[model samples]
Target: MGGGGMGGGMGGGGMGGGGPPPDGLRLQYKAANTTADDIQIKPHFKIVNDTQDNVPLSDLTIRYWFTRDGGANFIYNCDFAPFNCIYTAGTFGAATGVKADMYVEISFMPDAGVLVTGDTTGEIQARLHTQNFTLVNQTSDYSFDPTKVDFEEWTKVTLYSKGVLVWGNEP
Candidate 1:
């Protein structure tokens, strides 16, 4: 027979029918500002975890691949929870000219015991580059596909708590 307790799931304040506590995970992103260097353009997006869970902050690394509309591809690896609020791209050549057809996919091996009822998503302030990006809040089944943010420049992508959407409240 199996050893100790019924092992599986986020296990916190389980649902009414003893199912599972509502998932308290909300991830968000926004850009601080944009800079055009003598060589390239540097734009960054800030990510936040707006929830009451011991959310995964950093240490867990995630690999990302970006495919632009013009079939340009970029690959990089970052932490599941980055210590830095903003994720900055290397550089966009001055003359190359860029298009927004940006599809981004991130994958990582989730670490156990990191997600709880209350945790700091990240210690960062929010910045809204209103002119550059639009915001979208949606739910996911832990699976993701590259999504487009805008048409011309890059996008500020993020993850939102499904629980908040359903309960109309955030703990």
Candidate 2:
């Protein structure tokens, strides 16, 4: 298993901080199917609503990146997700050589009130398809971890009610 870090903007002070996060909402994420031969990498995001305040989530935007760590050489192709979701490839482009990295952003919007209910959760399942996604060879100062391909740079969850902003994780 690999790990990623989260910065404040979504609620709590940081990962595993004490006290309830602001707006009683937090992002819980995980990545699976992270092997060298795995043509597809799955990254799942779950919206954990911890309070009774019924905040309606209308949209979710995730900005993330993949670091080669200088391990292997590969190409990243397309991205896939369920309905109401969109994927945008970042400007840094795909990881091609040593120390190369790729950036991607995804946006999702479930049915209104699906992600904003208190004491319940809403989830998004996404995948990234790649060609030769594994790090088989290494050159000087090159590092890549298959498990670290799903790091999230930032995320924005918009809570809305009647077209008004109830709360949000984005600035």
Candidate 3:
């Protein structure tokens, strides 16, 4: 049988026998206030893939919003890169599995104009508006099992600001 696993009755399992290996892909974000000022916040994110097969990841997106005193403001709306601006080590076939760490850092600059007005203060609430990661076979097959892919729920993180809150819960 050439030891090729293609169909039933073959000693080796079928090509799709074992199917894709279980993937333990995870996307994580870390937030920190680097400046002494409480308003400045930095968010860093990393993607870790722990699967035997090389998974093709594309169309990754993450949306974020910041809120103070019930008022929210959209902060980021773009694709997430693994390292610099969102990193992809390789291209097309050249790309290997995401075994190492890939990440990006974004800084949140609050509207100083609003803070100066002095409405409410001392606490800033942040939440992930939307995050989506799609995985597909190298052959561009959409019918691939969705369960094998990994998706994460919105994550929320809050930071303390020394300044007063200036905006109201209008928009």
Question: Which lDDT values do the candidates have, in the order given?
Answer: 0.26, 0.39, 0.24
Better of 2 and 3 by lDDT: 2
Cα displacement (angstroms), candidate 1, residue 45, comes to 6.2
Clashing pairs in 1: 27-159, 52-117, 52-118, 53-117, 53-118, 53-119, 54-116, 57-81, 58-81, 60-80
Best first by lDDT, ranked: 2, 1, 3
Tens-place lDDT per residue, model 2, 40-147, is 545555556665544333333343345444434334333433333433221223534433354334432334234434644434665554345544221211222334
Model 1, 1-171: lDDT tens per residue? 111111222433322333333354434332222221111111223233334434432212111112222223333223233443233222211121122223232222232224444543342332211122322222110111224232122222332221222111111
Task: Indicate which candidate wins on lDDT.
Answer: 2
Model 3 poorest ten-residue lDDT run: 162-171
List model 3 lDDT by residue over 57-168, tens digit each.
Answer: 2212222223221213323222343222222221111111122111111222221112112122112222222123122111111111122222221132111111111111
Q: Scored by Cα lDDT, where does model 1 land?
A: 0.26
* Model 2, runs deviating above 4 Å: 1-22, 68-100, 110-113, 131-171
Best by TM-score: 2
Candidates ranked, most accurate by TM-score first: 2, 1, 3
Worst 10 residues of 2 by lDDT: 1-10
Q: In model 1, which regions exceed 4 Å deviation? A: 1-24, 36-71, 77-100, 111-113, 123-156, 160-171
Clash count list over all predictions: 10, 5, 8
TM-score of 1: 0.33
